[model samples]
Target: MGYSPSIYKFVEGSDTPVPLDMDVVRAVLSPYDIGDPNLTVMDDGRLQCWVRAADGSEAEIFVDEVGILVERPHSGPGVFAIVAELASRLGAAVLDPSSGVFFCSREAHACLPVDMRKDVIVIEMTGEGVRAALIG
Candidate 1:
């Protein structure tokens, strides 16, 4: 089976639930400075693009309300590395080494309330494969 992307709150030592916000997410991701050639902002604000690996394989990357999702069916281990690279670029800390659960940097996390940071939202790409959301 292909890897299904899952979103989780990265806040450390806090149990408060906070809903993902696109603007806050944007701020956290600003450091990546994702350029036009590598990334594109859709009309609805979601980001769609491909992240190329050193081996020349590319993984599909989408960022929305549900969180950042990466899918690279045939790319193998490089796909996870791409996810880790993206998270690092966003200044987010990887909470789970296995799943690559990342939390926005402490500075960015302050923008949202503790309560809003609850469940991890796993976005399901539909059959049409057109639906996507963004954090900011």
Candidate 2:
């Protein structure tokens, strides 16, 4: 079987859908030291970034009103850790639809609610920004 893409959905607590602020996105990603940053606005309106991964691989990451998209994401454990860290920084949650795994920024895993049967996620855009939740 071909690889299934991993998706991260972002939402805000207040229910307002706001376009992701590129400045905040940049600040959140800066610590990763992604080399050769090339940012562009795609035809569909999403902001795309092409960067050099730590393992010397080329990676593409995109952001928009819906969420952040990672193309051909790394499957390493450190990648997940970085995801968790990013979730924490964004005050968001990361849900693995394929695996039904949920990572939260504000609380411990034990306290978060998850529905294993659901494969879709709904991101709530709050006044402060976004918070992720599982749906479908």
Candidate 3:
């Protein structure tokens, strides 16, 4: 899935509004809790995630505070494991379809004193999942 920074404007006042920049968002979001290392941290400090679509296409997300890389037209094994790892790390949950499209939310993750629950929208991938979704 492709992300535009403007998607966050809807939740301007939400507790976990989406990140304005893709890089900052990845730095903040959480991941799932399965095994097999769905998400991985590169030696360069970048995060990688994988998402498999129903049509046999896969989405790979590479995120960092400085850049965001979303690759499409690929697929492999352990797609769910990658998503689960991302959810666990971000204290979030994922709803994915075998067709390859998926949604991720971190509202249930660790909440701070001023945080509220809201469905932060993001695509599930094999690399680092999301940036952040806040409560408006």
Candidate 4:
């Protein structure tokens, strides 16, 4: 019923590795049959995507060159899985901008440069739900 904070592709603030583009998005989501995803020409000019997580919950992601702009995160832990997958594949860490919480797939966390000992919240997806730790 309510909205979650906007998520972002981050590698320490605005220093993301590469600018995200529609072409790459299309490639990544191709397996899902999302089909030629394009940006909505609204004020934000974001590419909207509807993704269904393995658990059957769906989420709407609005992305641009800067990464996720607005998220209509429907609900459930599945949305986090969606974000983790994107982060892992994109080679970037996910950030909940408002909370300053960083997220990365467990598979990729060890390789991240987020100063894992800096005492920030980092979350990883687990089969049961999620795992959180105070690390940057």
Prediction RMSDs, each to the true structure = 10.4, 8.3, 10.6, 5.1
**Model 2 C-alpha lDDT versus the unseen true structure:** 0.46
Off by more than 4 A, model 3 = 1-58, 66-77, 92-107, 110-136
Per-prediction TM-score: 0.45, 0.54, 0.30, 0.58
Rate residue 31 of model 3 by lDDT: 34
User: Which is superior by TM-score, 1 or 3?
Assistant: 1
Estimate the TM-score for candidate 1. 0.45
lDDT of 2 at 120: 31
| lDDT (10s digit) by residue, model 2, range 59-123 | 46677764676555444433334444445555554545555564453432222334421333333
Clashing pairs in 4: none
Error of 4 at 105 (Å): 4.9
Q: Is candidate 1 or candidate 4 better by lDDT?
A: 4
Clashes of 2: 11
Per-residue CA lDDT of model 3 for 1-136, tens digit only, reads 3331111211323444343354334443333212224367889876666545334445566666433344442333333344334444444434322223224444433231223223334444333343222101
Winner of 3 and 4 under TM-score = 4
Over 1-136, each residue of candidate 4 has an lDDT whose tens digit, in order, gives 2444443444443334447655666665444434344433447665666766666666566777766642555455665555555555665555555466655554445444556525334455431232132111
Q: After superposition, how far is residue 23 of candidate 1 from its true place, in Å?
A: 11
lDDT of model 4 at position 98: 48
Candidate ranking under TM-score, highest first, comes to 4, 2, 1, 3
Location of the lowest summed lDDT over 10 successive residues in candidate 4: 127-136
- Model 3, residue 46: distance off in Å is 5.8
Let me know the TM-score candidate 2 reaches against the reference structure.
0.54
lDDT (10s digit) by residue, model 1, range 1-136: 1554533344444543334555554543344333555357889877766555444545566676546755542333444445444443443332323444434434435433455435322322221111121221
